[model samples]
Target: MIIEIAAQGGFGGITAASLRKTIDVSDQPERMRQDLCDAFEPDQLARLASRPCTNCADRMTYRITVTEDRGTHSFTLREAQIPPEMLDLIDQM
Candidate 1:
């Protein structure tokens, strides 16, 4: 699986940095693909994806993308809106 975290938009129209990491969970007995799907809640992801951007000053926007054998899911949200599970997943990656 591949996990990508990108930070864009900051104070004064500044461009924030981005990061990407690849994790190989193929060795485990349980499929890593299923684990990733579990980690990404579809409802929450839909909400985040459809939510309008406030364009608040100095606020950092975060975009996370997960790629797996099945497909890819991408979500964009503000820094403060990031879910704990997602954060933990990012840390694991």
Candidate 2:
């Protein structure tokens, strides 16, 4: 699996300084993958993707993309909207 996280947009219609990171999980052990999957919680991600925020001000917007053997999924969230589990996942990477 490969993951990419990016930050874009901000208050006053000013584009925030871009930030991004990419992570590759293909070489991880099965156990590690399972743990990551559990923490990532695809169901939660799906729900987040389904209800994207339409407006944001004075805040950085985040876009997280994950690609795996099955397929790819992406989610857009504000800095304040990032889940703790997702934050942990990012820290691990």
Candidate 3:
């Protein structure tokens, strides 16, 4: 069953049960979230560190830095209204 959550942070909070036993990369929201986080966290951390004097936590800008991977590249992200999809595995409260 595909799940979507409104309260949990990040790509929402996806529970294990919301996914099928067989893995499918194209249709899995949870897997997409994990993959996105895996690919983006390092860059996000780097962007956060460049602003030392800025303390406006409510809104901030990302610092773009270029570095060599296979070649030189630059990337950045902005604080936005990305929606999080949440999942619930158990009904116990």
What are the C-alpha RMSDs, in order, of all predicted structures? 3.9, 3.2, 13.3
Which residue pairs come into collision in candidate 1?
none
Q: Candidate 2 clash total?
A: 1
Relative to the true structure, candidate 3 has a C-alpha RMSD (angstroms) of 13.3
Name every residue pair that clashes in candidate 3. Answer: 5-85, 5-86
lDDT of 2 by residue, 10-93 (tens): 568877567788866666787767766665555666676667565546787778887877788787777556667766666676
What is the per-residue lDDT of model 1 for residues 1-93, given as tens digits with 9 covering 90 to 100? 565667666567766555555555454347555565566554566676676656446766667676667678787777556667666666665
**Which is superior by TM-score, 1 or 2?**
2
Q: How close to the true structure is residue 20 of candidate 2, measured as C-alpha lDDT?
A: 85
Candidate 1 residues lying further than 4 Å off, grouped into runs, are 25-37, 41-43, 52-56
In model 1, state the lDDT of residue 51: 66
Can you tell me which runs of candidate 2 are displaced by over 4 Å? 27-35, 50-55
Is candidate 1 or 2 superior in lDDT?
2
Where's the lowest-lDDT run of ten residues in candidate 1? 24-33
lDDT of every predicted structure (CA atoms): 0.63, 0.70, 0.31
How do all the candidates rank in terms of TM-score, highest first? 2, 1, 3
